[model samples]
Target chain A: MMAAEKDEQILAMIKSGGNPERGYRMLMDAYQLPLYRHIRRMVQSHEDADDVLQNTFLKVFRNIANFEERSSLYTWIFKIASNEAFTFIKKNNRHAAFFDKGENADELESRSVSTSQLNGEQIREMLHVAMEYLPVRQKQVFSLRYFEEMDYRQMSAVLETSEGALKASFHHAVKKIEDFIKSKNLY
Target chain B: MEDLRDELKNIGSRLDPAGKNESWDIPEGYFGEMQNMVLVQLHESKSNRPNVNLRNLRSGLYAVSGIAAMLILAFGIWFFAERSHSIDPAGIQELDQDQVYAYLEENIDEISLDMLMTDKQMESEILFDQPQSEEDWDVLLEDVDLHDLNNIF
Candidate 1:
């Protein structure tokens, strides 16, 4: 079934006066993976992503009554998830204090990467480090475009930006990431 | 996805799949457990919430009573303000000379000679304000001696 049709059924079930829990579970089952992956990419930590995703779900549950479904249900959920991820990043203060010293990158690697392949781990670390240098909005644009594979129209809905501005931001973010990789001699 | 990759290709960039070779690991059955975790958290939060109708009724009562109290306070202030203005100063300002005399006669027992002396100035005029007009002065000076005027000066 199409996601839109599924979403309509789920909305009906939840808005029905009986057995809203079933609807909520269905909603989570449909969205949890994509939402988790998006949040994980933005926050770069499993624990933080977990918190953000759970918080996102909690907000969705609380505010579903207010969700007018003006945008697609998926877009609405993504918007909440994006906002929660940004809130986590802003509250942590670690994302801002990352300098050329690579202290936070090393720390993030130790906490997040527990792999045997050191080369892939280093490349992932380099990517995260480069992403860290991006401004918050630009990084969000890049993550939504690149990692989440969100088109500009859907992204425009979730980010509340014009398609032109989002396209420009994504382009700048990619260029910046490419430059960072080149400067680090990791390209 | 094709369009995005194509656009990037036009930009001469190789951001293929955004590090597809480097994948993040998740706990086993994470998505499976996610629904249960979220449901548990939701139920716990809902249980912890105050009763919605009761909370709304309480806030409504508070808001209505607050508005009533503000109105009563405002009315009380306006009533007292109006009464104070109309009772004392307006009553006196509207009174005539005869009414003033009548009031003084009625309240004379409440007043003392010292209090009366404190108001040395005559009513409707100051006693020493060149007490007479120029006509009176001219008439008095017409009957006065030059030496008397010099002595007064």
Candidate 2:
């Protein structure tokens, strides 16, 4: 039931390469929700998140043999999910489309948060739109830290970034998000 | 790290932080559906792998076909050229002038009357067109080098 125990069991099953169907099912059961949430936050659309999540698991299954156990399985899984999210975005040029509306960042922020709902739901949607404006690494660091509550050390392992750099990136992201919130008067 | 967290806490205090429990929605039973879909995809991938030996066999067959086609084309060209330049040894045997004369005499009856008339006209022309005089003969002889006769032969 504990994450560590489950990770070890899944690792053993996958490493054995026997009863791979059971192993794969267990792997999916263990990681599916968490990985989906992570991917969903990054991609910001249910359909795209679904696709990225599936691809992340598919890549995991395909490349499970090459997993060297150098890092925790959690970190490794997040790393793969992150890479898949980034690749999907880049390949589809979603970043360009998100930014190429001929609207300034201030106007875009105002438009995104201009929903009928005036509660926390509106704020959350506004936050999501604001996230789209961050540079790639800053967004990633901020998301992992704020949403997932990941520590700098774990983030470093997953992102392969230095902890100090991740710390800097997170602060920068926070400042940007705060400035956007103030400018949009979404409060 | 604590400073970063503190700063984030301050920034998101007025706004709910982006969290997993945000109001995103998915179709009902999506994960259950995805499991089956992913398994099917994996199985299809496994099934779709090209057989190594089969691929190699196909390649070999293609290579053999290409070589055979080239050989057939080359042979056809050679056959065409050989046929165009073909000579019959029996038909090309050397003949003496007497033999030619005898053969012509044998075939004289086969010649048409018109052909005989044409031949007579040619002979008359030649006879009438003889050298006019010794001077003319000398001029013609001067134009002809007997040594060059060997070159013609």
Listed models, DockQ each: 0.25, 0.20
lDDT of 1 by residue, A1-187 (tens): 9999999999999988577988998899899988888887677778888889999999999999888989999999999999998888778854533243222555654543444444755666666767767777787888888877888999999999999999888888888878876765555
In candidate 2, residue A48 scores what lDDT?
A: 87
Docking class of 1: acceptable
Q: Which stretches of candidate 1 lie over 4 Å from their true place?
A: A96-104, A107-125, B18-22, B52-153
Chain B vs. true chain B: TM-score per candidate? 0.40, 0.34
Residues B16-68 of candidate 1 have per-residue lDDT tens digits of 66564335688998776777888898889889988769788999999999999
Model 2 chain A: lowest-lDDT 10 consecutive positions: A96-105
Clashes of 2: 0
